[model samples]
Target chain A: DTAVSQTPKYLVTQMGNDKSIKCEQNLGHDTMYWYKQDSKKFLKIMFSYNNKELIINETVPNRFSPKSPDKAHLNLHINSLELGDSAVYFCASSHSFGQRAYEQYFGPGTRLTVT
Target chain B: TQLLEQSPQFLSIQEGENLTVYCNSSSVFSSLQWYRQEPGEGPVLLVTVVTGGEVKKLKRLTFQFGDARKDSSLHITAAQPGDTGLYLCAGLKGSNYKLTFGKGTLLTVNP
Candidate 1:
């Protein structure tokens, strides 16, 4: 079983379109995260939710919002996507937050292309 | 902002050779982790070092944490083609739940 899974492995959409990427983890983890990997392969944390509570929010624009209906699911929604939004989005989960955060398990990334 | 800097952004080496990748930071960390990522897949955890001057080994891979907890290193011995991937280092400072990642080092092992 895939511990972490993401939908829409590849997404190609036009500029100014709205898109959503869904992520689910069966690891029974308490914390879930959304990360963006740019063309340079630099990974940055965008948002993190601990047990459905927002715990970390980076400098990401308001166009991007993350929703966690429960502890097992975290979804990312991008509105008015721009060309610069082209990158790989990865979902991750960990057993718990804080000190145990390093042992995160990541899902296969979703490649988003904004034309 | 806490940042982790990785040296030698790209490396190409032959099989059976040895190589080292370093991750440095100016701020102290409570723990540091090393992850390896292959194409079309997310990163996998290789090792996590939490103490100063601590070393951990996983088969042919050796990881070291700096005494000051501000840096870490990954050394591979007799690297094989299977070892080729992007190596990333992430650090957790204080009680932060997020990890600050470094720009990864892409290693290409030629046979």
Candidate 2:
């Protein structure tokens, strides 16, 4: 079984469509994060949820939202997707928050293409 | 400028060669992490160096953290085809506890 897994590895939709990417971790983690990797291969943090509390919210657009159903799952929903949303979205989970905590485990990544 | 900048944006070498990837930053960090990502997959954490000037080794890989905790480096010995991937370094930054990632160095090892 995968320690971290994401659904619909590839998502393709129109610019104005709405979509959601689901993520889950079996590593018994307390924190989950979403990262966006653009075509340039620059990985940036988009959102982070620690114990169901919103922790890190980068300068991401308001159209994007993260919902953590519990400690093991973090889902990202995008409204009114734009062409700029075409990037690989990654899901990661960490055992804890501090530096000494276990390293983060990343999912296979979901590539979203908005045309 | 990136909070953490990785040099040589791209690297290509022959098998059994040696290479080093660097990640630099002006701001200090509590810890630095290195990840290796393959195509169509997310990054996999290779190592994390916490103490400044600390050096850790895993197999043929060596990781070093700067004395100032603002930078780090990854060195691979006898690089193999399996060693090729996107190398990224990140530091825990800001009050947000978010990772400041470098642009990443894509490595390709030729046969």
The Cα local distance difference test for each model comes to 0.94, 0.91
Tell me the lDDT of model 1 at B28: 94
Across residues B1-111, which tens digit of lDDT does each residue of candidate 1 receive? Answer: 538999889999999999999999998999999999999999999999999999999999999999999999999999999999999999988766788899999999999
What is the total number of backbone clashes in candidate 2? 0
TM-score of each: 0.97, 0.96
Q: Worst lDDT window (10 residues) for model 2 chain A? A: A95-104
Candidate 2: segments with Cα more than 4 A from true spot:
A97-102, B94-96
lDDT per residue as tens, model 2, B16-95: 99999999989999889999999989999999998999999999999999999988999999999999899999887534
Chain B TM-score, model 2, reads 0.96
